[model samples]
Target: MPETGSGRRTLPTVADTEAFGRELAADLRPGDLVILDGPLGAGKTALTRGIAAGLGVQGRVSSPTFIIARQHRAGDHPGAIPMVHVDAYRLGGDLDELDALDLDTDLNHAVVVVEWGLGVVEHLTDRHLRIQLHREPESDVRTIVWEWIS
Candidate 1:
């Protein structure tokens, strides 16, 4: 879990994608923003589920597409950070809609993960972990490339 700066991984299954997320979560903390960029069926929500597990947050982790966002409270652990999972695809590049989510405020106490958040949510923080998941053609494999942008 050392900050090696950046790395990429190939996941052959959905479980592998989530496990990779758990490993990545070891390096995360409150006030951290993680932007997941990818197309449909890229396993972004699955990855977030792993992150939520690693963070010990309570609640069922699922895609927030319909509601746009979902908040998962931290479990019984003292000082555990909460999680706010958001789907920015529906925003349609609307800054006003993005601002309404008030993600910056959530960053004060939770780990914010946004699917399809690449260009839209970067302004919420000066630094963020950007992970891109790309599904291979005609296969279940996914390639994840991640880096910390400051």
Candidate 2:
């Protein structure tokens, strides 16, 4: 069962993180927004890889830090869901700059996942699912916490 209040997941390994992502993906739908916040090396991308796998998206899923964003098209298959993965680590101080990214265009048919978007991107919509990852020091364990916002 999902943890009360926070819906937390204690992921001890890379595979566990991915599995959590996939489990979350099962409930995602078009136009849904998932915001992720965590320090470097917190397994955000690893978790996203699992989400993509759950969505039935083909191709490699990696951090798009350089490109800003990457779209994974859902192939012709049952239960396929498109994914728009974005890295907001490079954006400037202005939230207005996010408008240029054009993420809203396809959001209606895909799940938009934003990394490091704690403050800038949440204003895009009133309803969203936010995930935070915290890595344990001196250990590979990571804690994942998620909650719904409206």
Candidate 3:
């Protein structure tokens, strides 16, 4: 695993990547944004699953590609905030369409995680944690890079 700059971690397997997401969720606050960057099958959704677990969300966690956005409320975990998972793969050239979804309503009281969010929704906020996942050649391994930008 390779890392650039400071405070970044590389995960070796899908489970590790998800575990990292859980750890990250523990440190997230209301209004926190997470942008996931990766090609197809790079385990972006798997990471989000970890995030939901960390946030004390129950039930199953799946990619909301067809629905655009899905909200999950915190369960037994104390002080746990809501989790808003967004799949930007279907988004067109403009983000206005996303704005129309009323995602902003939960922006201040939930943690928003967007997959395929590289250029489309990167500007939604000034502060966010960017997670980039890449695959290793000829292996089931993946390299995950995390950066906190404010």
How far out, in Å, is residue 111 in model 1?
A: 0.5
Q: How close is candidate 2 to the true structure, as a TM-score?
A: 0.93
lDDT tens digits, residue span 15-98, model 3: 897898788777877788888999988889999999988888766889999998888887876877789999988886457888
C-alpha local distance difference test of each model: 0.91, 0.87, 0.81
Per-model TM values vs. the true structure: 0.95, 0.93, 0.89
Q: Which lDDT tens digits does candidate 1 get at residues 1-150?
A: 654478889999999999998888888899999999998999999999999988889999999999999999999987556899999999989999889999999999999999999889998888999999999988889999999889
What order do candidates take by lDDT, descending?
1, 2, 3
The alpha-carbon root-mean-square deviation between model 3 and the true structure, to one decimal in Å, is: 3.2
How would you encode candidate 2's per-residue C-alpha lDDT over 22-73 as one tens digit per residue? 8888888888888899999999999999889988887899999999899999
> Which model, 1 or 2, shows the larger TM-score?
1
Determine which window of 10 residues in candidate 2 has minimal summed lDDT.
1-10
Which wins on TM-score, candidate 2 or candidate 3?
2
Model 1 CA deviation exceeding 4 Å by range: none
